[model samples]
Target: MQNERATDTQAALGTDTAPAGIYIHVPFCRAKCPYCDFYSVTDSDRIPNFVDALLKELKRRRGRVPSADTVYFGGGTPSILTPGQIERILGAVHDAFNMMPDSEVTLEVNPGTVSLDSLHGFRNAGINRLNIGLQSTNDRTLGFLGRIHTAEQARNTYRWARQAGFDNVGLDLIYGIPGQSREAWRAELADVTRLKSEHLSCYTLTLEPGTPLADRVNQGRIPSPDEAVVGDLFVFTCKWLDDHGYRQYEISNFARQDPGKGIDLRSRHNRKYWNFVPYLGFGPAAHSFLDQCRWWNHRNLAAYLADVAAGRLPVAEKERLTRDQQLIEAIYLGLRQTDGIDTVDFRQRFAIDFFDYFRKAMVPLIDGGLIQLASRRVRLTAQGMRLLEHVADVFIQALE
Candidate 1:
């Protein structure tokens, strides 16, 4: 039965007609952050075992994907692994998959976890892009977020990445902290733009359920994030980054474009997620989607490791989307990007008239200056992004 399913999935995935990506989730963290809900544990001792299990999984899933053009090492903190370990993993990836020669290999690094020499080693280990987690420029805010590194260390890490010959570097920042003012966020943007990294992702902090931050808010220890303030900061950031020569590609991602050189710095791996391109994720809590089916591994590290050790695919759940579910996701994911949904492509793919089907829902949104239907595409205006849920809900309800 499993062989039959694999045969059907392979037939559905096709022969690499479209670009695909690989995502490796490194689940070990130095310490768990209060606001972070992503699966990670403080078990530093298990790193070696985790790497071995990951390699075994990679070998087992060798022919699952035909080709990959992007490889992203995302994490609880991928840089916590030594450069030699990273090299060994990449070597295994090369042996197990058909990696493109010009693949955009990215590694997520947190400040203070990486040193200058180690950064150089990572570069030599085939990591061509670096995404540094510099959540804030304020020390107090960093402390509040339960981050292990200071503001200065984040800056030093960025500098060291450049010194290590990494030209394509991205930085992540968070705004909308409790009691944060619009002006404070503006200053934070000011500080980040000065670094002029190739890419910047500015996300508004969300108090995810079960996270320490959420507990603090629930217990009245910390004030909840102000939505209005976050909205203002979002607007300011869009305009600020635009004026600073950065193009907003996704809702939170801004890439610096050098028109003269034709350098587009948008994250290639992430585009797969938004565009429904085929990609596979490996690790605890990792989710994967190809064709109309999506599956995820066990979120628990022990379960994941045990399954891999037993030479079984560690997937915990799988779902083949119904047409309605696919349409809902198309709207939800399409609206997250600046490119929006291409009406022509939508009609061809799903045999539904994009504008006509959603006419009722798009009317109020378009009239309210929340979305724009132009150039054969439907995209959210800056205001719409602030109320993305409301906009998506309107479209989703119409589909229902």
Candidate 2:
């Protein structure tokens, strides 16, 4: 029954129009992080077959290929794929899609798995940007996070990436671990700054349900950090990064230099998500958004391959956004960036003044120092950014 429903959803959303971005999910990992719930398997026994299936699926969807400005290879660890496989997939992308000459192509890598040769191959394969998962510079915290790479390993990989001719490199870091301290967080930042990366994404560790971290908390095996401590750390992050010339472009993202200079670079692919630009996703657990509807491919790899091999679309679920839903999402997503929400664009898109549409909602947020309205634009204040989820809840309730 679920399969039938998924097929129906795919039929409804599938269309031949240019997309803003293309996202390919590589669902294979060397090891699954204890806190990760993303669909990925550690075993490499079926990797070759899976890659073949991915290529087949790409071919099947070629007719619907859209001009894309960005192509993102995100995964359990895209670096796990052999250079030859990566090359083949990229070749298929270029052949099928209308890619811009200066289009940003990115691959997510794990520092421990990356080598100079691999980085070079990825660049040769047309990957212009790399996002390395350097969750923490502290080995002890890294171990706690189930990350395989050490701080030195991450630094070495970053250096090699530069040598491999990748000017636009981004690093991912996480803070607010169970036993983390402000000084420790600062030291992590210090280590990251030395890399002089174009972009840096620092995130607070959340105990997601169904993950080992969450289980530990549930069983009283670990005590999660207090909310006050977490809040303090967030505030410290903003000030500290800014002081170091890493401006906060989004709530958790900081850039050291101009994006064009390979500093302060934004994730062009992810920006599509925040800006609600249309994108097409491929492979198992991939997602697509278009014509006000969102849909996802099957999470189960075997099922995805079987359906695709049979020349069937493997979509698993979808939703068509209502007018209210779209409006709410626009507010929620747009306000996440430091650039804030453009009132003119909102009016042009929805035929309503954003301020007028949600005067009541804006009033309290403004008073609470959570938002600022200026020149017909609205944006989250630093304090407001801290409580982004809470603000989103208020917006949702207002719609209700």
Candidate 3:
């Protein structure tokens, strides 16, 4: 079943739609993953100071933003904090902002750090959703990725999370690991699908520059998967989930469809990002966007803490997007999901016909089988999703 929430295109283009959200970044980890590049440090000693600073930041930013319908606690492992710490942060948010009664509150949990009691306590503390990092069910793969949890621990974590009363749980999985075979990918996908979580994020592993994994690949410690193999696996992954009854929403996101219950479990907080909804971000290295202005916090924890201690907004840099830049972002982001682009909405929002304006870019993409044009919407074909990076490049250059 399609999700009940309006597509980002409709909401952004439609009048009287104000989507505001809150994102809290927990920048601490027990140990940094070899593949992780997000601004997290392996220092838990300073969490108390960070939490105090965060609440102050929240209070300080009051009145500058609107009430939010969604709040997400993501990080280096939000589960690492005590339930009380989490509750305090959520409490500060409620005290400072006009949070909706049924706000979708999510907390990102890692397999090794959470327990049944803690999960239940988190629920009691007001988190209604859990996003667990279960990248693979293969112990070998887990080890390769520097994960502290075993395959069994990951499964147990899911069971415990369910028992702790989280109906909207999301499972994060990764494919396209170096030396990963189709059989391995199949096994991983099967392991997760059987768990029946409300949402699944099947992402292809990328060796982002400067990460340990990328450095290893550069030095021949491991061979990067062949591009063709990754491509075939991506197709297989999409078809496999679709065949299993998960609704593919964004490229990496799929919502479960339980015919018995008739529920659509798409992520509300995440939908805001692709939908161009406004959001406020706190803690070090987090980003916020609103009113065409996009800003990010300090990337270094020391800098972040110092600024908050001194009553500063810790923002490192911000930009106000021009109308032309917004147009470019719309095309790139619109094509990243199954919803594609709504031409009519685009015309209305930007006061220009997408087809007439982007004729040169759209026609070749349409002819090349990379994009499909409909009466009201234009979307990427299955082939296009596989080659999206290249397709995005074409659109980016079209702006030039």
Candidate 4:
């Protein structure tokens, strides 16, 4: 059965030419956050080897490369790489693929890992955007979150990026952390708004099962924030950001001042994911979606390197989305954007009237103030946006 599934996935991969994005996974960090489950090693020695393997994989996948409009280096802390190393990897990208001239290239940086000089080096290396993790603005909350940088360090990094002439900067923040108060969260939001970032991503802390955070909660060493409080905080976030001139473009993301600029300034690389565009993800545990199939690299670093060394794709697993599955995905993905799902586009792609097909399912949500259909576009209301996962599930089940 597994072999059959793999064969099906491989067959699907050969069928279509999809829009492409590049995601380079930097699998090294100074220290792993306890809440993080993403694969990364603390040993710096592995980085050079990893970079070599990554470049090799790029060469091997060159034939499959499509013209890419966006390239993202996400990580265990991509900023941990030297400027030269980043430049080299990006150089390989240019060599292997036809990168669009106006491609939005983003590098993720941790507050502690970046300096003014490094930020300048990154810009010179062709990274057009910097996403700095500023999980919280309160020092105690920062320590509790196990972040290496203090609140001061985070603020300085943001300033440094701006001074370095990076106008397209993003700040990532987390709310609903254990022991974080409403007032504290409000203050954090205010501080971030003051930074006048081009983009902001706010996420509620989730205690993933089997993570250290989960273990602490189980042992009563830490308490989970009440769900009701977290829900309230989510609403507060949308209102606060919207009032401060940041538009909620997606459920977790907002942008500063200009709605036109905000709409134009979204992470083009990330938009591909929501649009179900094909992307090649390189590095251990990175997942790739191509044609109608998805495959993931081996989670084990050794296994991934061995496979790459042996001239085999380091894929650990693969799945081909069924037509029904694709339809469901389109509904969920389309609903995630602020522009929402377009009735015409849905019909054009799938030969189905999305509205007519899902009217029964959407009626209840609309009545409950969870969704709104305006100007032939369907989008989640502010209330519905807070329960996006639940709303997505309803739409998914309706496909059945």
Q: Using TM-score as the measure, which candidate wins?
A: 1
Q: Across residues 117-189, which tens digit of lDDT does each residue of candidate 4 receive?
A: 9999999999999999998899988877789999999999998998888989999998898767789899989
Best by lDDT: 1
Pairs in clash, predicted candidate 1: none
Rank all candidate structures by their lDDT, best first, as comma-separated numbers.
1, 3, 4, 2
Write down the lDDT that model 1 would get.
0.88
C-alpha-based local distance difference test score of model 4: 0.84
Which 10-residue window of candidate 4 scores lowest in summed lDDT?
A: 1-10
Identify the runs in model 1 with alpha carbons over 4 angstroms from their true place: 1-16
Q: List the residue pairs that clash in candidate 4.
A: none
Model 3 regions more than 4 Å off: 1-17, 260-262
Per-residue C-alpha lDDT of model 1 across residues 1-400, encoded as one tens digit per residue: 1111222333232323566788999998899999999999999899999999999988988967778889999978999999999999999888888999999999999997999999999999999999999999999999999999999999999999999999999999999888888788888889999999999999999999999899999999988988888888899899999999899998999999798997779999998888778888899988888777889999999999999988899999999876666677778889999999888877766666778778887889999999998889999999998899999999888765
